[model samples]
Target: MVWVRLPVYFYKRNDTFYFSRSIPSDLQHRFNKRKIEVSLRTKSEAKAAKSAAALSDRLERYWDSLRMEMIYSRELGLKVLQDTKPCTTSEYSLSDALALYHRLKGGSKTKLFYDVSNRSIRYLEECLGHDNLTSIEKSDAGRFRDYLFARGMSSSSVKRVFSSVRAIINLAIREQGLVITNVFSGTFIPDDGAKQQRTPIPQDALKRVQMVCQTLDDEPRWLIALISDTGMRLSEACGLLTSDIHVDTVKPYIELIEHPWRRLKTASSSRQLPLVGASLWAAEKIIKEGNSFAFPKYCSEAKCNSNSASAALNKWLKPRVPAGCVIHSFRHSLRDRLRAIECPADIIDAIGGWTTEGVGHKYGDGHTLSVKYRWMEKIAPKVRELRSEETVT
Candidate 1:
């Protein structure tokens, strides 16, 4: 005869001692407190009595644990049991977690995740294509790292894929209650890591980009000036609406508040950027015209390619801008200008939507434009001076 310890309750059925285990107090609390009938199926009265005694002891232990402040351990045990129990529905799968993640994210964020996850998933599929979640082991992750190296992927690239895969597994464990440990945790992938590179264009190069944007027919050309001056990400610039631009005063600025359906990549990225020099003028022209978005009409929306902006810049303005200058080079150029003028790192970080100090250093909470513009005013003159020198050269 097997006995399980559970809370005890009684029912008056046919005037007999019909003893059964009650639901756990926490679970019962979820329902209204009311009399409920329960039945204990036992062959003999002695077995029923033993069962009732065991249930009573269990309830007493539960109350004692609560009084002794061991609720955390009890809750953890309950969670483990809940996780290990057979699913009322089909067991959750890795694919199910991915689907849930997609469903939870908005369209723009979903697209971003898709872009990053696509390559990661491909690498995972190549390594563990046939393996289910239950079959994955630490050796499998190690083997995947080996495969990445064999395929000639850089250490940084492999690390990125590994991180993404770990994230996928974590989401599964957290959201789906999958009975699996994260295999990638504490595992060190070799890193033939390259130095973190910043590709900021020099002052001469920036002048050329600006000159190109000025001559080009496309409206997004102004976006080039904005990015060059403000150091906003291409996506942030692309997502910009006219409402975000404030230009009534001498000190004009763009508010990089929350995007409609997109969260900033980092908290620091959600800041305002002040407009100055040619960039300010260009933005003003666009805003004054009453267009809702700064880059409303992407040249080719069919494929939703951001490279089209770069392509347009390259085709029309290559001659004017310096060699090896991309659209993002403008941000680099701005950062360089700030460094030259000896602006405070915090001020520069705040303006550039980079959290490079204190809390931002630890967890990357981005700064505001008000903080950035204080430094922008100092650096803007140097940038203009360099542009003038370039023309003379």
Candidate 2:
């Protein structure tokens, strides 16, 4: 079979082929450079041709997007095409879209959630303040990823921040009849799976911290010990009310429900966590005080309750725990321990407020507190047992 030759653009320098394409004359002024050149970094013609083809396609799409922007946004030095709807009041400001998006979608979320959404938008404003929403391009999204990385954000974090950015843009497009494509819709962040931000605290460090926790007579310490066994989220524990504790029942558990003061992360996050080991002791102490809120210092109406607890807990745990372990790691540890003990997956998920895959939706009334209590106690991550295992290992 004979290979049919097609048009190819490549230059060879120092025994390596590089893809080269001259910018369209009409769009050259829009770009900083007159032409685009990408190193194929291959001496073989076959390899160079394949690499250059992909690069050329990307450059073509980018140039076409630029040409479309010029026709739609700029008035002079272009044909008055009937299809081009010139940008005027049709394009909204990024700042305005941010407010509109938050007001519509962020009403019930926690302060920290809103902060992340707002901060992501603010970072965009810092880079391209008051830029038009419809005028945003793929290049802008790429720059945003670089900006987050330059500020030392992890790939996971950068991906999360971009997700918020994309949500804001997409929400405006879908709900409010905004016209632009979400440039952030399919933006990629490299190496997002390289390092996980949260990991289970090592058994040795957990045992040591549990030992030190027993000695301190402070609210943060109580909070730490309370979550040590139950694997409660820092926010859920902080925002608990006196009414949420159920130590009097046949199987005592912490009933996490939303209140006037604090909202839960998800409907599933509102769960009954069985109190065992250190958690039982902590609950008794919390009951002894008889305050309306479990931890009054952090649960005030005026404060961002979850953030207040996070700051306090992280500050206290930073020195005590091993490197890379934070307050959230307790939840990770509990999940790992439950899995290690061979507990049923659904029960473990229900105990942690995680969504069950296909369990209890049809017939049963869901796992009862008594059933959950047994499983929770079975894998409570108690200092004595876990520490002994660690020592033997």
Candidate 3:
């Protein structure tokens, strides 16, 4: 007599176990593909069996939920449509999807998230009217894209809107177990060309702007001066705590970290920026003020008001800086200045908190603050001196 292990709906491929199952006919319309396959990502038969069992249970529950929804809809006098035709209506509408998306993903997100998502839905309603999630077609998605272009929205902006719409619909589809295609998934967005380019401020214009910031010496000016050299995003600078600025320390750097009110844009965005030139001056001033938040007018316990900061700063900067060069242009200018000094690319990326490519770049604790300070010091010069040199030449 021999004992045999129970068989699981799993097979081995490339020495890894994969779970494969067939969709029931009733639920076949829900998924794009006929068969459901997932990598169990383990070599051990026991682990693969366990994973397959769990996944099978979840799929059965999901299919049962869909069946229940269909049964409930039939009870509500809703007509069941054929597989060839799109559903006339669904339990989830575009508005319902947006609400579900907000409830699930809006936690710890900035105001911009809500603003962008809401604006996208508003545009959809304007172009296509409010429709059920399942009723949205690929043609409708294309029309929405064209509508955005006609409204003078750039390709990048239009794509962002579509991205928000897609996420909203996708969440509703998964959560509600709806059988519907995401029409907004694959729309082609055109290139924005030079329209999207944020021109780097000219060196002369940059010097003059920095000088004016010093003269003004107000809260907004301090923020401008700090960002001009350090290349922090507006929100990142706005959300700083006074404690984040370390002027008296041996290195005199800004320890950029994520706060509840303000999150770093990327993992790379969280870095210790060495204070130099105008940035150091601004840091010293910010610390001397002894406020709880670095830029109290733009930041607080609840949120970092970056939109308000941008509006005010851009209006003030319009006359001071060259056209096409807004507050964000300082970040581009910083990269250019670093390049002029022949700073290493990786070091520059690290200093500016720009994501560096390649797996090797992730290996070690990046270039130390002292190493960054040395490179930044090369660009640290008096605006008056730099301006005078231009005159002499």
- The most accurate candidate by TM-score is 3
List TM-score per model, in order.
0.65, 0.70, 0.73
Q: Judged by lDDT against the true structure, how good is candidate 1?
A: 0.63
- TM-score of candidate 2 versus the correct structure, residues matched by position: 0.70
Count the clashes in each prediction: 6, 0, 0
How does candidate 3 score on lDDT? 0.83
Q: Which stretches of candidate 2 lie over 4 Å from their true place?
A: 1-91, 192-194, 203-207, 359-363, 381-393
Q: 1-393 in candidate 1: lDDT tens per residue?
A: 899875445444554445444445654432233222223334456655664564455445644644454467566674324334444212344455566656665356636678776567656644553213544567877888898989998888888888877877787677777667888776777768753564667776666666555556247767777777788877677777788888886678988876653356787677778987667866776887777666766512322345556677556545555566666667777778988988877777777777575543655444445556677877554334534543311
Distance from true location, Cα of 83 in model 1, Å: 19
CA-lDDT, candidates in order: 0.63, 0.75, 0.83
Tens digits of per-residue lDDT, candidate 2, 129-197, equal 223465566798888889889888889888889988888888777776765688887887898465766
Scored against the true structure, residue 171 in model 2 reaches a CA lDDT of 78
Q: Across residues 90-135, which tens digit of lDDT does each residue of candidate 3 receive?
A: 3356777888899999987878889989899878865653334554
Report RMSD for candidate 3: 17.7
